[model samples]
Target: MSKVGAADPAAVLKSFSSHLIAQLESRPVKDDAERAAAIAVAKARTESTVGVLLSAAEVKALVAASTAIGVTVRQDFGTRVTDADFAACTALLESRALDATLALANTKAGLSALRGVVAKQGAVKAKLDELTAVPVDDALRARLWRVLEAEPFDARATVAFVMHELGGADVMREWMGTKESTSLGTHTEQVIERYAKERAFHDVKAPPGVRLEPMLRWMLTLHDIGKPAAVEHGDRNMQHAFTTPVLVELSKKLGFSEREIGLMRAVVDNDAIGETLHWNVNRDLDDAAKELRALAKEVGMAPGEFFELQSLFFVSDAASYRFLLERIFTTDERGALTLKNEKFEQLRARVAGE
Candidate 1:
């Protein structure tokens, strides 16, 4: 029976829907894929009904996996690039001479000298194919190396291409199989715009080179997958911990090193520590570091690596929270960090208990 005089329009709609559903004819699902998709949606609806609202981060990660990782079928699934893109990428890499234009310098000796390097590159690519299951082209490899090698640190080329490959603006709750910690928008350019500026991108640093910047940016996007502090249901760090398997799954697909995965976890596992330290001021810097060092050890990072990686992670993360960390600490020429402050008072409130 419909509620004719219900005070709420929504109550009337619900009564009408219940009556309508009882009269609807049953239909079989078209196929297994459709059936599975329906099941997944039903499960998600049930969960959302129970009130742990799927964080934007969780949805982003799941959607990327579904689209690109073969977890679910999509109408646009087979849109990988063809002919000229691959050819051009291949030609540029093989043609560009280490010395300038390999073709021009080709005495027999010069060509002979380059053979070993070329062969070694081929061997590495073959191994990469076996590991990643995507017969990635030399062009993509060279471009990624170039991005990592670019001075002043840029990843736009690779990130943009990945955005395209992962459905670009269309499917991007996030593209590239990761989610942003803020804004939860479909675009990632906004997040990139917010990142702090530092010099020394790829153009090849002697030791601690441009790799760190891109890696940090890439994984920071993963840090808050399901971790929106505003509407989040539970502990943020714990939720981050719950998402580690998803992180590790994506990390393995991307060919990240174990050390790098550990760094990602370190950043996510303790993301809010800086804010807590600033607000409470119960622990001094040394005392606070002891807590973080323990976390670094649990993640199997060296104290040195943790100190360097997490400090950068801290300042970058802190800027949004106004934790006053970026105010004092700064990175060196190589992007290694140092807390170059004599003023302890700056880290805490101007007056105690104020």
Candidate 2:
């Protein structure tokens, strides 16, 4: 006669962890011990099998749970299956089999399914814990990622804001600083180069006696400076781009010249026009190229001479401004040609005539 024992923690943990624990408990096992082994071997031919060695405590709980639900236990070590193998087989016995004896025979196959569930439970729990430890919901994390990719906020401010709000500042910092940083946070030199290229091309022709290069650089830089500040706001107000005037005020306090302040102000107030203009027009330039040419004509300056003026405005706008820059300057068709001097001249003459 089999003796009854107290429940084992490990055994209960495993059994309770099953997705079908409630159902498993209600079913009863049919065959006795010796007959169950013969059936397990018969069914093992078609099933992918595994062996398990249960602790003595676990064995007792298994017996008790199984017996409470009328599960049959077969103790047959004589067959090719080892004690470990037979223990695994015993786990497979189904209590609700239509043919009670057949359930004992298919025990090995049943064990194979149970093992799969157990392994899956172990792995899934580990993964879930890893995600939870980050202290933010996955959906919220994904939203933060979208904001990062948008680069809609100031770099430093955005980083600080995200860290304060979300709890994984170090990882985010590493990601932002890495070579894999998004376009806005990517290499600063490349940004300068691209800004230079676009600024050199705004409008049909460089205005007579106007310096284009320096002015354009300054404008682009200033345009994006407020992204970090705006990110901190983290609201639908979309006030980052609107705060250019404030930066102008700050620059004046910092001793920037009146003329330099105007350039910064222009960048800050770029959106104030009655209507948003096309990217390449003389009046509503989207990026540095048009702005440089416009400023040069307005001030009767040249590209190189205006470098300091441009750099002042450029650096102040910060890295977050890339969002508007990309949208305004991007061509609808990939690889479209940007305006050159000749093209600029033709367009200018036509506009002048009109």
Candidate 3:
């Protein structure tokens, strides 16, 4: 019935050591002196084991817990534990446990150990959620815009900043875990910036009174929001494009008009238009053009405007994957996918004529 955090480190360590001694006592120790020696060694080993796994924040929490229980822990582990010490002890323990566990046919203990590891992961995720739960407001949004302007290439951090502003840090973390090499935030940033530059240069057409920049930004930001949900539930087949409804609902709550939400959702649904163009350009130009026409109709965009928006995203998305551009493009030296690319130019001409 004792509270978990109320115990001092000395008491906790003592209890932990006692548990180890009890487990050891079941083993074939020779005499009372041997048992006493075993207990002493076990205490040192147990302390050395847990000390290495604790992070700086966890160590600070443990120290505070110790202080609350009237026990000083400053001199106990030299302020911090070394990684080598922890790793060595952990390897020893794991080797012993593996040997013993493998000796038995019924591997319930091994299963239990796996479950414990999973439980620890859950605890870490909970802590992350708590730490990232900053309230989204106008101030946070402004700060995010400033950071995006200052560090345009730091897409991951900028996207994290935006997610944090939208109160979606947990979602962002899940998405980030699934995409080790990809940066949704950076891709979105590049897409918006590319759209802006194109709109300034070309006669990219859109509906009357519709601001392209804000619409593109909103679309790109929430385009991949559903990715985390798809990843979390083991739904590997779920297309992230289908998640635009979530963003549409969110925009409604944020006071965006129905027409604005429709435009954003259209962009999201057609976000992968660039990928299709990239992969299918050589094999079936006519097929690619037909697909674009259908996507434009579905998203309620004119064929010309739809092609322009999708081309902007296509070029920017390719640019964002600079490291992987060689894999994406066949004859690219600098890995820059520009409007001058023959395939892209061909697609543009075909769409413009339509």
Candidate 4:
């Protein structure tokens, strides 16, 4: 039964929610090709749901597979354009050059080149197919590449498009793989470890479980998928921190559960460790407020901030972050890590403590 007496009329009506729903509905639903890509990811990730929250590698593989299959399909069904056709077309344009016009020849050449490129199995072939997938004429498609090649845009559409083909989550992960450690990763891991410590400190004897590790790991990996578009392709270092529209779309598309997405966004929104803790305390006014406040002070923040920070700390996976850190940074004699050495010690201590 619906709560009749005191429900907010706005909650019931949800004008903004309805509008968002409608906007989402208006978009083209993922076709079989996209769905198959998504399903392939789901299978690889062992996710129960049927969707496209694949890693960048998985998306790349899927795109390659799909493009290869698409090429075969087109080859089987469509007439193969020959070099003779292109020559004849070009000849039409030149009154005496070849008896074919350049325009017609260019068209024939473009079509044939497209087929050839699509049929070939390689990086360039995949990129060309992706580029051609856009709804535009052959001339404009060719022009797009020329413009991109001549002067790369600050936000290189080719990179973005290729990355998009790779899929958002997968691309972001790949981007992260290339960078040394992301500051966001540092801040996130620190926050989680701190929270884990605090939680242990409060309980004093409890083990670290109850859905924290997987949750946090997922959060750190996913918090920045939308950053690229948000920062408009700024330095690779800074993109992870920006809150782009792509993040939201990715959150919706990826197989992450709703709670996971919420928690992931919570970390992204409160990305800064200090700010996150401050928010935590402010949000809660319970008996542990004193403890949280004290903890916040230790971390160099107010009590309120400490509580808010706790939620963020445990919001994602400390263990996974630690693993990545360990994997990325080999330990030395003192068990001290090499790269991001200072940050590593901080995290090491936090993990060691609990």
Candidate 5:
């Protein structure tokens, strides 16, 4: 028998199918043939082959079971389960169960529950704990990548992945906060989506060797990772820029190499430079150009590459600012960074060297 309270994927699937069949049978179908046809139709609609009519209570129960194992069900699931719903729930459970099981397997409470099963299998508790402690499942990684790719701009999804997959949601929550105005998580998501849209519009490409999309997503996602620590220390003057070193170190624990971590750090640091240049656009053009060149060197980017990076970061960051989004980028043209203010116009001219 399986360990008590352990999430058995097969059992879960069986239970769901049973509940669905029961619900379908209770419905007003004239005959077994009619019922089978109805079930077939429901199954066709769902990505899951076993799809059938489900009651509201059944849907809720399925969702609760999935959630217990750390799977997030975003869809309503309705009174009937679709193929898409089944597939989504199944995938979620499959991925989340591995991590949850591994986490549970490493704990004392988990061991106590598993004592009977382990004794039957002649497994040593210490060895089992050691095996499960690492918790590095490739399937989980793949699922998270899919989530990021599909919902590139979703802050909640991003946070959920980092917290559940990477094991640090509480810390991330402190950094992100609840309000949009002060939330680092909100700002990061806005920057990533805006940057992505701008890059595609302008045909801006990433540096030759870098995988641009994933790199940008990872960089922007963790750019403000150090904010909570800064705030905790009462360092009101702390900018996310000043926390690059900390971020770089923390990222190492997340499996980033030195080179990758270095690139991320440079991007985070340069974001501050972009912010400064953005604010000082109406100042001397020559001075701005000089600073831009210096900033480029500091980040080890060529002049042209730096310009592209800065423009992407500046525009994206600006778009996140409520004041700037409303007052400065006022045009209705999609993907156009039109400036309504004279200062912004001057800044644009300087950046363009016009």
Candidate 6:
């Protein structure tokens, strides 16, 4: 085959990415017509089927290039698709395509390119964790994502907040063995459940009497902190494993307590459980239960305690469950996402409101 197609996807991507970014930088699209013509010419120069698999750093570099031209990739980068071949990345042509990708949202191959617009790192002007939510859900979705995109939180404070609230003495005592957990703890492909029996959970609430909003907020911000390292390892999915040690060292340097440190380790270690299930969409009840139980054992928790604490990571780990209905395969396999547990539904709805 050609040198660019299969032989060197990264090189091919770099060449095309430079061209795309350069077009906007040079002439600059001052209106819709120019925007359409520029990207279309760029798209036509390469075969529609011609695309590249990117290393995490490469993808980030592409994103940076895209951003320099004022392309709003925050929505694209902020969102994760289970199986996104990154079809959207291949072409940055239309306006609506920039809106939330359709059936793509439901598929494992789902990854997004851009959304409405970009604003530096984005602003959390309102308490978007609550979805500020006066507008329709789609509008709210974009707005809330901007909330997650804000990357200016105090690294130490965020770590400390997480350790102080979720990582406790009890959690510490429970943090024995502590085997490393994979991003999608169960490594098959897809979380095989037609309908999730576990009432779509979202751990968005602050604890009983404490001001734990920051912890919850950080859950949104910090879950994927190790992505840069994960990408360096050439697998974006491995961020969870990398995040554990990365944060542990950061916490230690920040002077957190050992109790907090140990529990912090546990919390970050298993943060990928939700997304693992999200990206992979198998519905074998027996298989899922087995995976869940196995994960608990790996982390030295009785299955009960594991389930209880998983909520902490579900929010931090990934928002896959919160937005489950948007997934194409999820709806296809399960008809519609469901849960017998009213409590879980209530919790998820309060935060997600989707």
* Per-residue lDDT over 212-251 for candidate 5, one digit per residue giving the tens place of the 0 to 100 score: 5666667777766656655664663354533565456545
lDDT of 3 by residue, 1-354 (tens): 112233454443343321122123243434556446444543464543232343344446545544443333331332245785545544655766755334443466677788876764453344334433455456655565555445233435445655655666555545433334544455555555554444444445666556555555556666666665555546643434325556666566544567677766665665344544454534355566777777777656777778777766555545445543445544335433454336666665665564
Q: Model 6: how far is 335 from its true place, Å?
A: 21
lDDT of 1 by residue, 1-354 (tens): 122222432222222211111111124434556445444443332211111123334344433433332233111211234564344334545655434244445655778988886765453343233323444455755554555445554435444544443222222342222233334332233333335442222221212322466566666544444333212333433344334544554555555667677667666666334543454544465555565667656655555455545545554454433234355455667764344643333332221112
Candidate 6 is scored at a TM of 0.30
lDDT of predicted model 5: 0.53
Query: Tens-digit lDDT track for model 2 on 1-354?
Result: 222244532233333321111122223345455235423332342222333234455456655655543542322232443564554444544322345356665776898888876764443344224322444455754554444344223334333433455342433333222223453323333454454344433332333442334333333433433343344445313333324544454334333456655644544453312122333544432343455456544444454334334433332333224554443333425432232223333433332232
The number of the candidate with the highest TM-score is: 5
Model 6 misplacement above 4 A? 1-221, 271-302, 315-317, 320-325, 328-354
Ordered by TM-score, highest first, the candidates read 5, 3, 1, 6, 2, 4
**Shift in Å, residue 242, candidate 5:** 5.4
Misplaced by over 4 Å in model 5 are: 1-144, 149-155, 175-182, 253-260, 271-288, 298-300, 332-334, 340-354
Question: How many backbone collisions does model 4 have?
Answer: 26
lDDT of 4 by residue, 133-178 (tens): 3343456445434433442222233333324533332344333433
Minimal lDDT window, size 10, model 5: 1-10
- In candidate 6, what are the lDDT values of residues 187-301, reduced to their tens digit? 1011212112222342233223422333234333344444444555566565555555444554444334454445445555543334334445423434444555665555455
Instruction: TM-score each candidate.
Output: 0.39, 0.27, 0.47, 0.26, 0.49, 0.30
Return whichever of 2 and 3 wins on lDDT.
Answer: 3
Q: Rate the local accuracy (lDDT) of all candidates.
A: 0.42, 0.39, 0.52, 0.36, 0.53, 0.38
User: Candidate 1 overall Cα lDDT vs. reference?
Assistant: 0.42
Best by lDDT: 5
Residue 87's C-alpha lDDT in candidate 5?
A: 62
